[model samples]
Every structure is written in structure tokens, then in C-alpha cells.
Target: MDGQPTADVVDQVKDIPIYRTSVERGHFPILEKPEIADGFPDNWMTPRLAAALAAGEAEFVLSTGTNHARMQIIRPPYFLLNSYYKLWSEHPDISATWEAGCQRVSLTTVLATEHVARVNAKKRGGEPEAVPPLDDRRLDARTLYLNLRLDPALWERDDVVRMLAEIRTAQQAHPRGWYHLDCSGYHLAHLVQKARAWGLWEDFPQPASIIHAYEYTPLNVRRHLREHFTCPVVDLFGSTELGYLYYSDRHGHYRPYLDEMSVELVPVAPGSRIHSLIVSSVRNPYMPLIRYRSGDCARTLDGSPDPEKISRFCGREKELLATPHGPVAQADLDDRIADASPRVFLHQLHVTAGEAVLHHTTFDGEPLDPRACAVLERELRGLTGLRSRIEHREHIPVGKSGKYAWLVQDR
Candidate 1:
């Protein structure tokens, strides 16, 4: 790692077994999950790390594996949570709300909700309850988890009523009747649509600030959120292993939050606008990953490798699709679909041997007009160089991870 500007990191890890070879060779290759797991804690054990563990200042935890395989990692207690709070308190658009003692209500995945319930149950020496108490779902003094179903589309009236009642309770707890909303953009959208349909929208408390940080949010979904909410709709791009790296402002432009970290963008292929995200972060003291491939991809404002110029955290590099024109990213296709019609909501591209089919559902439960469908087909054909068609459905299902997959290939 010679010539790397992060000299402090080099000094810190130069003696660690996993990084010794790279340090000696003056070249650090991208660190993969398997390599980190092969040796485990023994490879990373140093006097400082051992002492931290002994003092209960650090502990081992597993990544959520939302986008990839789960992996064990070490960090201080509540490391990721503190990082999020710091950003929220400092963000220009939402700082006032954060300082005003606004409580947070998270609505994302059933996996997350279940994880919390199970942990609380274990602490209480009891079996996991199907409907845990509200205090059990509270992560801390301020944050609460609210979703209990894998698919928001399957949320019955009772489910919606319970969640809205919780939101009302949270709102009442605040002196100003304001609370912050943290959610998966898709999940929040489904909740809004269902609340309106069931005449329960009046019961739902309006949020002072909204953040969708769970996964990749489609363009049309974001637009839908803006149409329904008057507050800021921000997107945070990061992972469980790495704390937040970038966040969008109220205007939807990304700004870097690399405090003790640096990033390098390597093209997925020659002559491609999409680049793989290789991160070197010392944010987690127990494990400082060097040149870690985060499995994510992005594009720059002017197609440069400069990290500050990053415009979009498109999608996972593994999800990029090959095309005659070049590689196409999720954002690449989303831009076209949004242009064809803003009504298009959740969409997945199913590519087979000779043709590509777009399966989609709309916010209003209706298919696109004939002209809009034709325009979408033409745009997709030009982008992928394949026969393309649109198939509208009333509903689309989420994956086991409680997130949607934008691409599915049968070839």
C-alpha cells in the first residue's frame, strides 16, 4: 500500500497477518469476504484488539446479508447506530428535526423486526413472541421498528392498523407531535397506498423527516414518495459492514460522508460508465478493511473516477447486465422507464435466451397506455439490443431478504 495517502491506516495494519503481505508488496488487492473469514479473529488479533474485546468495548456480530452472504465481523457496541445518529444530527436539511428530540420509527423488513424481537426475547429468557411488546421493538430511547410482514403487499387491515396506531403513539410521545420516519422506500410506499385504501390515512402521523436507507429505491418510487409527503425524502447509501458513505440532500444530489475512509472506483470493464466500489474504511476500529470490495457499483457526475463526483449509487456490481451496447446498470434502465411513464412502480427485467420481458406494477393499479408501453419497449430495445415487451401486473413479490430484485436472468 505504498503511495496510499492514508498513511495512518498503513501503520495500523502493516503488522497484521492478513495485510502484512500486501504491505510488504506495496500493493493491496481488493479484500473479499472469504479471505476475511478464512483466518477469522486469529489473523486479526493484536494487543489493542484483544484488550478491547477483554474490556467489553468490542464484540463480534454478523452482517445482515441483505445483498450477499452473511459474514462475521467485530465492532464496538452500537457502532453503526452511532454513525447514523451523527449523520442525521449534522445533515443540513434534517439537523433541526434531530435536535428537536424527534423520535424515529423504522418500517423496513420483517427480517429486521424479527431479529429485534428475538434478541429481546433471548435477553428476557423467553421464547420469541409473535407479537412482542412495543418496548421490545424499541432499539434505544429514540428508535422503534414497526414492520412485521415479509411482503408489505400482503399486509392485512389489522397489520396496517397496528402500525399506524404505533405511529400515533410515537407522535403523541413528542411534545411537538413530530417524529422522524426511517424506512425502505418501497415498504413506505405500500403502507401509504394501503392506508389510503382502508381509510386509515387519517390515523397515520406525518413525519418531520424521512429517510429510505435499506436498499436501492427505484426512481418512480422516489417520485411517488415526494408526491405524497411534504418532508425531505433522503436516501442513504451504505452497508452493514461499512457505515454510511454517501447521502442525498433534499434535492436528491449525493454528498460524501467519508470521515475516516477513502474510496476508489474501478471500471467493471473497459470503456464502461459503471464502476465497482472499492472502499478502505477505518470507521470500525476492530476491523479496518483495506481495499474492500463492497459489492456495490456507482457512476460519476462526469464519468470520472473521482469519488467526490459520484452521482449515483446505482446497484450491485454482480447485478450488472451485459448488453451489445455495453454493461447496463439498474439505474440505467430505471431512467428510461421513468421517462416512458412515471406511473411505473416496481419492475423486474427477466432476460431469457433471445428476449427481455419487463414485469411491472403501477401505483394506481393500472397498466400504462399503449403509447407509453410502445415507448418503453423501444427504449429498452435500444438499451439492451434485445426484443423487449412490458407486462403489467397487479402485484409484484419481494425476495426472501424482503427486498426486490431488479434483474432476473434465465439464460
Candidate 2:
């Protein structure tokens, strides 16, 4: 488990105790969550890093652990956020938002619970503060603002009334102010959907630009944002351990923005188009992950595992559903649903030993017709070779992280 990256890229850490006594430079063995957790701080800790941690100079970043094993990584302060800012400032689509003097506002999935807490506190006319401390630093003269977080549980009747009131309050502070919507959480899409339902769409300000990172955004959510807002919707691919490595253009095509990192796409299985992302990053001063399997899965253009031709990041590697035909990924389900109809907003596939049930909702606020539902059920059976049932619901459940899962194994 104590394997050092063999890649020459980690030459800087060659003398470090953790790296010096471990595996060769080019042969980076997969670093599993269990292995990381088993050792915790001792395995990767060095004298300098240990001192920094004791002095509060380094911080622990918790993994969302939505679909993967939960783990924590220690790094310097603002390491991940600063890295994202750099990537954002460099991207052509996002740079325009910065130039327009719009600040970045994050309302993504992870902020949901905290967002709800703050909103409820404010409802009682109390001052609410942010947890994890907002990085209020300026990037290119534009401030990066972290507003209240959003949790899906609050999307219910009683709380949503308060949620809307809170959202309107935030919106009024910057009406038509051209702010960048940094939707790192689940709020924006749900906010838009619910606001429209409650006849309060006009109260929310139009974003100057939209940046989606930190979570897997459903196609329906993307469609809703694009149709309602005229701003550019950019998707970024990265994690807390690594900075923003790739970004989607206005056309939704991902292009590399690796600052000081390199990547290799290795197939999860032989002849499989889905490849696990193995990244080598010495970008973080306190931590360097070399040839590290990121636990995220992706596919390449033309169905080959070429790093340069990677087309789409499918989903988490551990979530790949085993089928008689082969492994079916989240992207496979997404493709099938979109082919059936673009109206399908959110979906969750619960795979049990006997059957798989698809709980889904459409954008029109109505259940899918019998024909469309049958088509989707058949598609699931064809791909997964499992008895499939389609539950056309008015609403699908969201995880506490405020993210939706395309596939879930019944435990």
C-alpha cells in the first residue's frame, strides 16, 4: 500500500520518506480507499507535513463519498480552491464572466445542508454564517463569493417556502448584476425548477455565466439552465485531491487545462471503452498523487482508451453495474434515457439481485407515458440483462450531498 509513483514527474518527492522507500517511479499501483484509510496520517505523513498539520497550516479535505469510499486528504490552505480559480481564470468561457466584473457564486450539491441551516436561521431573523469558511479572495479583480449552500431535503413544501425567500434575498442583492453561477452544489437547477413552479422565476437573477463542477449534472438540468439563461454553461472535471484538469467549452466538449499535471486513461477491463482516470499531479505543494487511479470512469472518442481522445467522464468507477452483456455505466443509462426522450430530468437505477427499478422524473412535471416508460424499461433490460421496472414518479430522491445517482446498488 505504500507505493511511490515511478513516474519521473514525481522526481521532486524522490527523497521524501513516503516516496523514497516505496514503489518504483513509473509503476504507480492503484491507491485504494481502504489502503489510504488503513494508514491514515502515518502512511503519507512527513516531518514537515506533520508539523504543518499540528500548527493548523494544513487542512483535511473530506471526500464527498457519494459513490465511492469515504476518505480524507490533507493539503495546504486554499489549495484546491486556488487551483480551481486558476483554471477558471484561464478558461475562455469563464474568463469572460470574470471580465464582466461578475463574482463567482457556488450553490452546488455539497452546500445543501449548510445552506438550509443558514436559511432557517435567517428566517428567524438571526445572522447566519458559513461553515468551512468562504474563500473571499479576488481572482483577476473579481471577487469569489460563496453564498449559502443548498440541500435537497429542503426542497419540500414547508422548507422550500423559506428557501425561496432566502434565494430571493440573495438575488435582490445583485439583480441582473451579471454574477457567475458557480453551481458546485445542487441548488441552481432545483431552484430554477421550483421557482418556476411557484411563479417566482423573475425574482431570481440571470447568471452572467454558469460553471458546473464538483458533481454530475443531469442532462435535463443542463437543458433547463441553457434554455432559461442566455449565459455560457461550462463544465469542469476535477476533484479535491487534484485541481481542475479539464474544462468543457461552450459546445460541451472537454479540453485539457492541465497546469502541472499529466493524465493517462487505463481501461477498467480489457476492451472496455470506459477507462479509469490515472493522474500524476505534483501541483499541490503538500501532497502529490502520481499515477493515482482517481476512482472516476470516463470513455474516449471512437471507443478507444486513448488519453487524448477522451470524450466523456462517465461516472464513478465503483458504480459501474455488472451486466450479462458487460459493465453498464451511468453514461449508458443517460444515453438510453435521452434517446427515449429529452424530457427525462433525473433518474435513479436501483439494482437488486433479482431486478432493477428505475425511479425517474421528467422536466414537464409529468410522468412519462406508457410507451416511453416501456421503451426505457426495455432499454435497461437490453443493456443490463436484468428484469427492469420503470417507476414514473413526480420526483426522484436526492442524496444528502444534493446529488443524484444514475445507478445505486441495493444494499
lDDT of 2 by residue, 1-411 (tens): 233344566566665455554555444565556766666777777777788888978877776676676678888876767877777777887786555555555565545335444545555686555553332212223433333334553465444455444444444446455567777434576767777777777666677778888777666667677888887898999987887888888777889877778787877877788888888778876677766788888888888756677778888888888877677778888888888877887788988998999988776778888889889989988987889998877766667555677777874
Q: Give each model's clash number.
A: 0, 14
* Deviation (Å) of 3 in candidate 1: 8.0
Report the CA-based lDDT of candidate 1 relative to the real structure: 0.90
Per-residue error for 151 in candidate 1, Å, reads 0.4
lDDT of 1 by residue, 1-411 (tens): 222536678887886788988888877888888898988988888889899999989988888887678899989888888989999999989988899999999999989888788877877899888877788898888999999889999999999999999998888989999999999999999999999999988888899999999998989999999988899989998887888999999889999999888999988899998989889988897899888989899999999888889999899888999999889999999999999999998899999979999999998899999999999999989988999989998888999999999999998
Clashing pairs in 1: none
What are the lDDT scores of the predictions, listed in order?
Answer: 0.90, 0.70
The candidate that achieves the highest TM-score relative to the unseen native structure: 1
* lDDT at residue 140 of model 2 (Cα atoms): 26
